[model samples]
Target chain A: MKITNTLLQMVKTVSITAITVLSFSAHAADDKVYRLKLAETWGPNTPILGDATKNMAKIANEMSNGRLQIRVDSANKHKAPLGIFDMVKSGQYDLGHSSSYYWKGKVPNTLYFSSMPFGMVTTEQYAWFYHGGGMELMQEVYAPHNLLSFPGGNSDIQMGGWFKKEINSIEDLQGLKMRIPGFAGEVLARVGAKPTNIAPGELYTSLERGTIDALEWVGPAFDLRMGFQKIAPYYYTAWHEPGSETQFLVNKRTWEKLPKDLQVILETSFRVAAFDMYTQALDANATSWSKMKAEYPDIKVRDFPPAVLAEMRKATDELLQEQASKDPQAQKIIESQAEYLKKSRAWTAISTKAYLDTQ
Target chain B: MKITNTLLQMVKTVSITAITVLSFSAHAADDKVYRLKLAETWGPNTPILGDATKNMAKIANEMSNGRLQIRVDSANKHKAPLGIFDMVKSGQYDLGHSSSYYWKGKVPNTLYFSSMPFGMVTTEQYAWFYHGGGMELMQEVYAPHNLLSFPGGNSDIQMGGWFKKEINSIEDLQGLKMRIPGFAGEVLARVGAKPTNIAPGELYTSLERGTIDALEWVGPAFDLRMGFQKIAPYYYTAWHEPGSETQFLVNKRTWEKLPKDLQVILETSFRVAAFDMYTQALDANATSWSKMKAEYPDIKVRDFPPAVLAEMRKATDELLQEQASKDPQAQKIIESQAEYLKKSRAWTAISTKAYLDTQ
Candidate 1:
C-alpha cells in the first residue's frame, strides 16, 4: 500500500508539472515578439526606393502596434545587393528589397516582375499586377525559391545611359563597354559590346575612371545625382526600360510566422508605397531634368539614333523569344504581359499618346 | 479733289455693303447648326478633373480618324441642375455623369452615394454605382432642370455632410431629420425615419412610400453634381466628404453646338469615364467591405444612437467654422446650401421628428 501511494504521488506531481509547463507556454505565446529583418539593396536615402522602405516600416510598426519590429539594413551592411534574394531565401535575412531582374540567372521568370526593354508603363504594370494576375504569377515564380514578393517601387521611364562616345549607329555599339543588366545586357553583349554589371553606388566611379565606357542608371534624376555628367558628356535617352519595378521580398518562413494583422499592414503599406513612389519619381524626374539643363549645360542629352534603336529592338525580340523557349514560366508571364500590353496599348495610343503627340 | 475722290469711293462701297448685309443677315447664335457646347462648373478637365473630357474627344476622333470632332462647352449649361447647376451642368443629354451626392436634396447623400450613417464603405458604394457614381445625384438634381447626368465615378475618402443638428448628445438626434445620403439613409432612417428628398424619378415614389427620414448631399461632389440632397436630409455628415471627387457636367448651349468630337464621339468615348466610372470605382470598392469588417467591425455602423456619438470631434468644429467664414468661392457654395437647408429643415426636422421618433 505504501509503495502504491508513493508511485501515485509521483504521477500526480508529474501531471501537475506538465500542465504548468503547457500553461506557461500558452501565456508566453500571447506576448511573443516577432522581429523581422529587412535588407535593402539601395541606401536609405535612394529616392522612391528608400521612401518605400520607410513607409513599409512605418505601416508595419503602426499595424503591429510595435509587436512586430522590422529592422532594415542597407545592401553592404548585410550582403551585396545582387545577393539579397539568395540571402533571404537561404534564411540569412527575413526580408529583402531589390530589382527582380538582378536575379535573372537564378530565376529567369523574375524579369517580368522588373521590366523588359521598352515594355509597359508604370500604370499599365500596376493594372497588370493588381488586376491581371501578374502579382499571383510573380508569387508563383518566387515560391520555388521560398520567397514572397510585393512590388516596392517603380522608377518609371528611364533614360538609356551616359555614354562616353556618341552612339550614332549599330556600329558604334560594337566593342563598346557599357554597364547594363538583365536582358538588355544580353542584347548588348550579343551585339559585341562588353556588358558589365555595376551597382548604382559604384556607377559614378566606374564611369568617371573610364572603367566603363557608358552606364545606364535610371533617368536624369539619379544619373545627375551620381555626377555622371562630369565624366560622360554624351547622355543618350535609351528608352530601353520604360518602367522598372523593384520588389520587397520576404523569406517565406518569416512571413508565415507573422500575425495576420501584420501581414495586412505590410501588404497595404507596400501598395501605398508603390503609388507614392511612382508619382514622386515623376515629379522628381521633371525637376531633375530642368536642373540638369540649367546647371550642367555641357552635358548633351540626345535620343538614341533610329538605326541603333532598331537594332536593339530586333535583339530584344530575339532575346525574349529565346528566353521563353527555354523557360516555361517566362513564356507564361511573357504571354500574359503581351496580351495585356496589346489591349492597353490600343486604348492608350488614342488617349494618352495621341494627346501627348499633339502637345 | 483727290481726297474727295477717295471719300466718295469709301462712302459708295460702305453704303452698298450696308444695304446688302441688311438684306441678307439677321440671325441669333443659336440659329447656327454644327454648334457644340460643353458645360462644367470648373476649368476644362485639368489633370484630375477634366482628363476624361479631354481623353474622350481624343479617343473618339482617333477611333473615327478625324471624321468626328468634339467641342467642349465649359460651365454655365442652359439652366443648371438643382436650379442652375444641374440643367446646364449635365451637358445636355448627349453625355452627362457625376457623383450621386450632388442630388442629396432629392435622394439624400446616404441613399444616393452608398453612404453609411457615419461613413460609406468605398467598395459597397462602387457596387451600388455600377452605372458608376449613381443615377440619383443626376436624376434628382439635374434631370428636373432638363438635364441628364450619368454616374461618373470617385476616389477614396469622402467628406461627411455639413450639419446644423446640434448633436451635443446622441439623445438630441432622437427625432432629428438629418441629411444623410447613400446607404446611410436605410440604416439611419430605419432607426427614426422621416421624409427625405428623392430624385426626380424616384422622388414621387420615395415621398409617397416614406423611405428616408432626412437626407444629405455632397460638399464638393454635390457642388459639382448639385445640392438637391441637402434639401431633404437637414443634418449632414461633413466628416465624410474629405476626398470625394467626381466629374460629368455639360451645358445645353454647348451640347447643341458640339461637333462630332464634343457630341456623340467625345462624350461617348470619354476615357476617364471609361476608366474611372468602371475601373477605379470597381477596384476601390471591391475590397472595402472585407477590409472594414476585418479591421473595424466594432466601429459603430449605426446612426448616432440618440446620444452615442453626440461628442463633436475636431473635424466637425473646423468644418463648421470654415464653412461659416467661407472664402468668396467657398462661401457662395456654402451659403447657398446652408440657406436652402435651413428653410427645409425648419419644417422637415420638426414636423417629422415627432412621427419619426415615435415610430
Candidate 2:
C-alpha cells in the first residue's frame, strides 16, 4: 500500500506524460529529495571556515544530483554564532557548523573534539578521531542533546596568539591580561594570568588602547586581516590549540530521514570538506606568513619561554585532572586521549618529527 | 521524436498491464548504470595500499546508489603489478592504483609526484597538490599518457631503511649495499652506496645472507611483516622518501564517459580514500611500532648523522638541478614544489614543529 501510494504521488508530480519512468522504479519514495538547512558560526565569505560549508553543500548537491540541497545560513542570517549547538539541538536548524569548544559551558566534553591545549597535531588527532574512539566519545556527549556530530573542517595549527609584551618567565604571566577563551582561558587563570573574551569587532581597539595586553586570534591566516601584526610585536607559536577542528552538527531526526545513499553522500562530503579546509588553511597560512615576513620585517616571531610554557602545561594537566575527578565520562575521554597521544606521538617523533627536525 | 520512440520502446518492454505507470518520464536512458574496472598493483588482501583501492570503490559505489559500479582487479588477477600504467593508458582498464615514481623510467617527470628526498611532509605535499600548482603539473605529465592522476594514498614517512650497521658519517656509506629503489637509489649512488633493487620475495634472504647490507622497504607498518626488525638491528629514520604518496590513475576516455554526478562522486571518493589511507598508515605504524618494540628489544632506532644527512641533501639538490636543466617541465614542477616547500615548511616550522619541539 505504501509503495502504491508513493508510485501514485510520483506519477502525479514527475510528469503525467512520462509515466514510463515510474514503472522502472517501483520504489519512487527512495528517490525523494531531501533538503537540509545549515547554520554556520562564521559569517558568509569567511575564508577557510566559511568555505568548508559552501564546499560541502556544493559537493553534496552535485554528487546527489540535487537530491540533497543544503541551504547554508551564515552567522549574519542566523544571528547566533555561539548558539549553534543549542540551535541544532533544539531543532531550530537541521545542521550547524561551529567549533566544538564553543559548547564547553553547556557540554564540557565538547571541548575535546576541538584541539586541546597541547594535544595531538592535525593528522595525529584525525587518526585518533577515526581510529582512537574519538567519534564514539563525541557521540556519547552529543546523543543526549538529540544531535549527531562530525568533523566539519580544520583551521590548521592555531598560533599561540599575538602578545604585546614578551613572556620571559612565569613571572611575566602574573596578572597578565590576555584575550583567550574557553578552557585555555581557565588554564591561564589558574597560572595567575587574567584571560578574557572580547568581541571580534573590538579586539583590535581593545588591544591597542591597553584594554588587553595580549590576544590569541587564529594563526597567521585569520590574524593578518585583524591588523594584529601592526600592534603586537611578538607572534608566538602554537600551544593552546595545536590543531583546532570545527564540527558539523546534525539534528538526529533530520539525519534519520535521509535515505541511505544521501546519508552516505552527505557524510562523505563533510569528511572531504573538512580535509580540504585543513589543506586550504595550510596553504593560506604559508602564503600569509610569507607575505607578512616580506611586508612586516619587525614582527618578531617568538616561542613562549620554557618556564612559562612549563607552568601552563602544569596548569592544563591540573585542570584536566580536576575535571576527570569530577566526571567519569570526562575521565574516560581524557585517559583515552592521553594513551593515544603517547603512542601516536612516539610514532610521530620517529616519522614526522624526525623528518622536520632533520630538515 | 526521440521521446516518443523511447516511450514506445518502454511500452513494448513493459508487460502492458501497468500502462498507467509507463508515462512518468520517457528518459529511461538516465537510469543506465556505469561499471568501471580498476586494476591495482597489489595482490589480493595486501594491507594498507590494497585497502585504499577497495575503500575508494566501496565509497564510490555507496554514494552512487548502484548507478556506478567499480570492479577492482588485484595484481594476482591482472598478472602485471608494474603494467598498471600501460593498461590504464591503453584503456584495458578504466582505472589503476600505483605509485607515481614507479614510472620514472618511462616518464622522468613522474618521480616528482611521489615523495622526494628531504621534501615536504604529507600535509604540506597535500596542500601543494590541491591548493598549489601540483595538480596542474601532474595533469600535464599524465595527459600525454591518456590518463588522469591523483594522490592515491600515503604510506607515511618511510624509514631510511633497515641496516646491519649504523651510518655514522658519509664515510660509512661508502660502498654500502642497500636495496633502495627509484630516485633515492640515484642519491645513494652519488653518496657511494651500491643501491640495488631486490625483488620483495628475495629481500629477507638477501639481507640475512649478506647479499645486501641494508634495505629500505616501507615504514614499521608494512615493514614489520617482512621481519626486517629481527634481522636488521639498526633501524634508521626517513630521508629518501619523506612522504611516499601513491597514485590513482583514471583513463581519460573512461573519465569522459562518466556522468557529472558520478564524476564528482568518484573524485571525492578518491580524495577521502587517499586521506583515509594516510590516517590508516599512521595508526598502523603506531600499532606495529609498539608491537615491534615489545618483541624486539634489541632493535635500535637511529637517525643518520648530521654530516651524512648534509651529503645526501647535497646529492638530492645536484640531481634535481640536473633534471631541471634537461626538461623545462621538470624545472617548473621542481621550482613550484621548492617554492611551496619553503613557504609551507616555514609555517610548519613555526606551527607543527614548534608544537612537537615543545612537547
Candidate 3:
C-alpha cells in the first residue's frame, strides 16, 4: 500500500511538470508583442495620404492579433517630413510612409519610382512595380541605404493644374508663369515656360493674387477643398505626374527582426492599404469633381492644346535622354519604363480606351 | 517537526496544481489550429484562375503561422465546378472561388455582381464595388443563403472574340454562329447572332472545324495558347463583360467561427490575391499580346462598326430592363450600377480617357 501511494504521487508530479513546460512556451508565444514606430510625411489627419497609414496599422494589428503593433507619428511629431528616408534607413523609425521622389535630391535614381512627366497610369504602374521588374529595380536602389521599399499608395492621376488663361497654341505657353515642381519643372523650362515652386500653404494665395499665373495641385479630390476652382478659370488635364505612387519604407533591421508571419501580415496589410487608398482616392475624386461642378458651375475643364502638349512632350523626351546619358542606371530604368509603357499602353488603348470610346 | 513537514508537503502540492492549470490555458491559446477547406471552380493545374486560389491560400497560411490552415480542392476533386454556391452554402466547403454570375440560374440577383455587358472597366468597376454600395448590395443578395461575397480577381478586359470574318455592320451579325456563354450570349442573340455554348474541352476543335464561325474567349493571356489567332483572321475589341470580376464566397458560419485575427487575415489575403491577379493578368496580357502580334502578323484587329455596337448596346439595355421589371432586387441593383457608372465614368472620361487620347 505504501509503494502504490508513492507511485501515484510520482505520476501526478510528472504530469504537472509536463503541463507547466507546455504552458510556459504557449504563454510566451501568445503574449509577446512586437511594437513598431512609423514615421509619415503627411501631416496629422491628412486625407488620402494619411489614411493609408491608419488603415495599414488597423489591418496589421487586427491580423496579427495585437502581436504586431505600429505607432504612427505624422509630420507634426517628427518635424522632418522629408527625412523619412534617412530616418527609416538609420532605424530611428521602424517604417516610413512617403513618396519616393522626395528623396531624389539625395538619390537621383529615386526619381523614376514616382510618376514621371508622362508615365504609366496607376494600373500599369502597379503592374510594372510587381511584374515588370520595377520592384527589383526599387530594391536595387534602396538596399544599399539599409532600407526596403514597397509601393505605398497611389494618388491617382494628378491634373496638370489650374490655369487662369486658356493656352491655345505653343506660343501661348511662352514665358507662362506656373507653379510646377521637380523634373516636370525642368521640362516646362525647356519648353519656354517659367516653372516655379510655391509652398502648399501659399498655392491658393499665389494663384488668387496673380503671384503665380497658375498652380498645379493634385486632382479634384485635393483641389476642390483648396477652392482653386473659384479663382483659376481653366483646369488643364494631367500631363506631369500622371500616376504618382507613394512608397512604404522599412528599415532593413526592423524587417529582418520580424517573425516570418508578421512580415507577411505587414506586407499584405500594406498591399491592401495601398489598394484601398487608390480606390478611396478614385471615389473621392469622382464625388468631389461632381460636387465641384455642381457648386461652381463655371469651372472650365480643359486639356492643354495639342501643339503645346507636343512641345512639352518633346521637352520631356529631351530631359529623359539627358538624364539617361548621365547615369547607366537611369538609362536602364528609362529604357525599361519606355518598353513597358509602349506595350501596356497598346493593350490599354485597345481594351480600356476602346470600351470608353465606344460608350 | 512533524507538523512543519506536513505543512511543506501541502504547499508543494498546491503550487504544482496552480502551475498545471496556468499551462493548460496557455497551451490551448497557442496550439489551437483551425483548418478550413476551400472549393474552387477551376480544375487542377488550371492556369491563372487556379493560381489565384493557391496564392490566397498560401498567404493566409503564412500570415496565420499555421494557426489557420486552408486546404484547396479544385473542380477535379470536388466534381462540382458549377455547384460552388451549393457546396459552400451547405458548409461542405468553408470557402469558394468562383464568379458570382455562375449562380444566376439559381439566384438571378447574383448575375449583377459579375461584369455587365457594356459596363464599367476594371478600375471603374472596382471603384464601384468598394465605394458605390456594391459590397452591401452583394451581401444583401448573398446573405440570404448564408454566404458573404467579396470582389475576387478581375479577368481584366475580355476581348469580344476571334471572328471567322469581319463584322462590319448589324447585317453581318444576322445568323452568325458563335460560341459565347452567359449574359453576353443573350445580348448577341437579341442582336440576331446564334450564340451557343460549347464544352471547354471541345472549344478548340469546334472553332477549328467550323462548328462555330466565331467565339468570344478571354483576353490574350488566356487565348494565346488555344492557338485561336492561327485560325481566326479577325480579332475584335470588347463590348461585353468589360471587366469580369470573380468572387470569393464564404460560409457565414465558417466566418463567424474564426477568431477576429484569423478573419482579418483571411479577408486581407483575399484582397491581396485579387489585386495581385489583376496586375498579373495585365502583365500577361501585355506580354501575350505583343507575342501574338509578332507571330500572327496577318491577324486583323477590328471593332464592330458603330451601328452594330449601338444595336448591341440597345439589346443589352432592353434585356437588363426586362430583368429589372421582373424583380425589385434586380431593379435596385441595375439602378445602382447605372447611377454609379454615370458618375464614375464622367470622371474616367475626363481623367483616364483624356490622358489616353492625348497620348
DockQ of each: 0.01, 0.52, 0.41
Per-residue lDDT tens digits of candidate 2, residues A70-91?
9999989989999899998888
- Regions of model 3 farther than 4 Å from truth: A1-30, B1-30
Pick the DockQ winner.
Answer: 2
The number of the candidate with the highest lDDT is 2
TM-score, model 1, chain B versus true chain B: 0.37
TM-score of each: 0.51, 0.95, 0.93
Ordered from best to worst lDDT, the candidate numbers read 2, 3, 1
lDDT by residue for model 1 (B31-66), tens: 123323344433444333455555555544443323
Clashing pairs in 2: A18-B23, A18-B24, A18-B25, A19-B22, A19-B23, A19-B24, A20-B22, A20-B23, A20-B24
Best by TM-score: 2
What C-alpha lDDT values do all the predictions have? Answer: 0.53, 0.89, 0.87
Q: Is candidate 2 or candidate 3 better by DockQ?
A: 2
Instruction: Point out the worst 10-residue segment of candidate 2 chain A by lDDT.
Output: A1-10
**After aligning candidate 1 to the native by TM-score, how far in Å is the CA of B264 from where it should be?**
44
lDDT of each residue in B255-303, candidate 2, tens digit only: 9988788899999999999999999999999989988888998999898
